[model samples]
Target: MTKKLFWEDPYLSTFTSSVISVEENENWPGKFLVVLDETGFYPEGGGQPWDEGNIGDGYVSYVFIKDGVIYHVVDQDPGKGAIQKCRIDWDRRFDFMQQHLGQHILSSVFEKHHNAETVGFHLGTETVTIDLTMDSISDEELQKVELEANNQIYKNLKVQSLFPSVEGLKELPLRKQPTTDEDIRIIEIKDYDYSPCGGTHPAYTGEVGMVKVRKWEKVRGNIRIEFACGLRALKDFIWKNQQINSISALLSLKDVEAYEGTERIYRELRDLNKKYNQQSRLLLEYQVKEYHREAEEYQGISLVSLVFEDKDMKQLQTLAAALNQYPNTVALLAAKGDKAQVVFTRSKDLSLDISKLFKEVIGLIDGKGGGNPITAQGGGDNVANLQGLMDAAVIKLKHEYVK
Candidate 1:
């Protein structure tokens, strides 16, 4: 079995290790299977990313483990006999170490204070998440845990790793039972925590620096807490402060007053919308009165023909419905805006085939429409053809209805 160097020194970024094996695997192309006696490259497992860097002069693309043997998948073969110089990206390695260590401390505190077991864990790019066995944890209780975790950080507690036998592990107080059978690697944070973890972690609590619970939510009868530590926490703080300043300026309000200002603006907009709707209704009512006065009574029918300038389709529909009370009347309404709209309606006896008439009339203006036989509505982007539309409607009415 290949020795895991990360467990000994999580901060070790570079090391010299002898290659134990080199083989070609069908699964990976242009890559060699490099097994080293010792390595600092943490394999991609336990929700943490694999360590990326160089082995000798070649770049290591992927680090994986098979049957307890860690393999460095590199770009070029460093030869089997040569001692490869392995180097890891120290910034990423240390950040992960801090997060992992912080999780151990925080998880320990949760189990100690509330008897909540750490059901799940995930180490992400920005933060680490720990799922508690309980359904919920209030904000006040979460703050207390955060305060306690940071206080432990200030103590500079010693974090030691020990390879204990199954019998030896039985004597120690572990937060969670060990899953492995070979040899349990127990990480102890002084008197605060003891857990069996194979992942790399900080040597001391002070190295973790800080732990901040950024957010939390309940999931599957458990509470998942998302947190950041060390450099990640510092970056998150800087980004959040910048966002607050930007929002304050864009809203033209003090940082403390920004949220209230936004709410006030939303309420004003809603009130304005109500006033606009009332005004539109009144305008449509006035237009309908004018249309009734100008209509000519023909053959026991009120023939209302109107031409409106810069009117919308909604106003036209309102006018059509308002004139519906006139028995045996034919109402022809037209409006000119970005487009020209025509609405034709007739009372009971005069069954105007508007769908057929629209197809013919719309062809002249390159438009399209569909409606019931008694009342039809059609429109086109030919605003200049407003007069033409009125003329066509009159001609079509004379030809189709004035029999």
Candidate 2:
């Protein structure tokens, strides 16, 4: 078995290690999995990502462990002969350490305080998450968790990792049982929490910087809380503050007053939208009056047809419905834009198949829609030929109904 140097000193970023073996990769040309006698790099496991750095003359792109041997997946093959210097990316290793420790602290708080069990965990590059065994956690409860987690950091409590015997583990008050009974590593936060974890961690809780629960969502009958800590939490806070400052300046309000100011503007926009809708309806009603006057008489029935530019579908419905007051009239209208929209409607007295007429005319522009015998609306790509399509429909209706 390879010596796990990281377990001895997680702070060691550089080391000298002899190559135990080098296996050439057939799938990835110019790549090799090199096994070392000892290593400081952490493998991707237990919700924490793998540590990245360089070994020998090539870049250490990946790291993994299999059958008690730690493999340094390198881009270039380092000949298996002598000792080589191994380097660990402290930024990445420490970040994961902070995040992993932060998760331990957070899950413990939720479990200890609210009796919520963390059933799932994922330590991502942008955010870390833990699925709590709860349907939902209220804002008030989450706030309390956040406050206490940060307080733990402020307390600067020592964090110890203990490897308890298989038989002795039964005595410890573990937050949760370990997956494997062989090697159970328990993390103890002094006067705070004791939980089983395989991932690395900082020496003290203060190194976690800050633990912030950003948001939560319901998933798999539980609440998944998305959070961040250390440098990631700092970055998030900086970005959010920048955005808030920009919004506050644009609203001509102080940082504290920005929310209320934005809410006021949003409410104003809603009122304006409602007022515009009312005025638009009145304008469409007047336009329908003008269209009714221009109707052509055929077989004692008025045929009102017109082509409008960029009119809404609702306007067409309202116009068609308003024109329906005329005893025996048919309304064939089109609104032109990138595409053409046509509406066909008749008064209650005329039991004509406007849907059939619409289907046929709409085919000229290759469009599809549907409605009953009295009213129908459709759209087509042939906007330029909208008037011609309406003329054809009107002529066909006249030939059929005209006496």
Candidate 3:
């Protein structure tokens, strides 16, 4: 077992300890060794990240635990029985302290006000999460918890850690009973809260600065609460406000007026789309009128077909439907936009083999398309070959349907 200096003094970032043992473990590559220390270095466990810095001028790449022993994985192995100086990155260590302490206060508030238990906890790089036993906690309820937690922070309550015997714990009004009998380290926040936790925390609640609930959601019959503390919370607020200001400027509206401006723009776009559809329908009707007059009659069978420069699939289908209304008539329409779109339809008593014709015509243009027999559709990217496509459709009709 290693003496956790973080529990003794959370502010201690540098210490001197003798390396009692240094032996490489086979399970780890590059470097692996455990140190029997007198002081320093918070191990990576209990959901909080390990302290990062140097041990006796050697870089500590990873710090972890195995069977309650803290193992510092350094880039260069230090000789056994050597006295090494250790230093932790204070900024990162302090951030973990603030977040860990903030969680203690927030969890206490949930237990006090709603009888909820802190079932899970995770300390992340940007935020900290605490999972409560409650099935659902509304936004309003979460706000109440936030308000109370920050209020306690403002009060600057004294926080103390004490090891009490199993019999001694019976006298203290604990929030939850400890599962283990091994020296229970109870963290008491004045009159506010008392719980058994081995994780590092600040000496006073005020050191946590401000607690803000960033967001929350329900997970596995519990409410998972995400929050930030101290500088983290402050930074999040500043970034979010900057985003809102940018949105207001882009929309050309005040902060309060942005929503209404967006709604108005959406409505105007919908109305413009309706007008555009009506104009397209009128244009298609005129094209159909011209086709009726120009169609060629063969044995009482009128054939009106043309390949137009660059038109979409929808326009080609509309033209085919309009020309097919004439009895004993057949129309084959092909339009090449970024790609080619073709539609063919025949009136009663006229049958056109469109699938075979598309394979023959489109294949010459190095494209692929196919459709049904009486009415066939195909397309490709050979826009420059519109004339060829029109001539081919006419030839196929002459050979297959005109007879």
The TM-score-based order of candidates, best leading, equals: 2, 3, 1
Give the per-residue lDDT digits (tens) of candidate 2, residues 82-150: 689888999999999999999999999999899999999999877789999998888998899999899
lDDT of 3 by residue, 1-403 (tens): 8777878997898888888787777766777475857556788876788887787877886787776678888777777888878888888888998998899899999999999999899998877999999888777888999999999999999999989887788988898777677857898999988888777788899999999998889899888999999999999999988887887899988988877887898899999999998997888788887887788876677778787775778778878877777788788787767877777778756565656666677765557766676677776776777668778878777877566
Candidate 1: misplaced stretches above 4 Å?
23-27, 249-403
Structural similarity to truth (TM-score) of each candidate: 0.72, 0.81, 0.72
- What are the clashing pairs of model 1? none
The C-alpha local distance difference test score for the whole of candidate 1 amounts to 0.84
What is the lDDT for 198 in model 2? 74
Score each candidate by Cα lDDT: 0.84, 0.87, 0.82
| Candidate numbers sorted by lDDT from highest down | 2, 1, 3
Candidate 2 Cα errors over 4 Å, as ranges: 15-37, 54-86, 134-140, 218-221, 282-286, 312-329, 345-382, 400-403
lDDT winner: 2
Best by TM-score: 2
Model 1 Cα lDDT, one tens digit per residue, 282-397 = 87678667777778766555778888886678777777877765676778788887778888776666666756676677756666676887778888887787678778877777
Sliding window of 10 residues with minimal summed lDDT for model 2 = 394-403
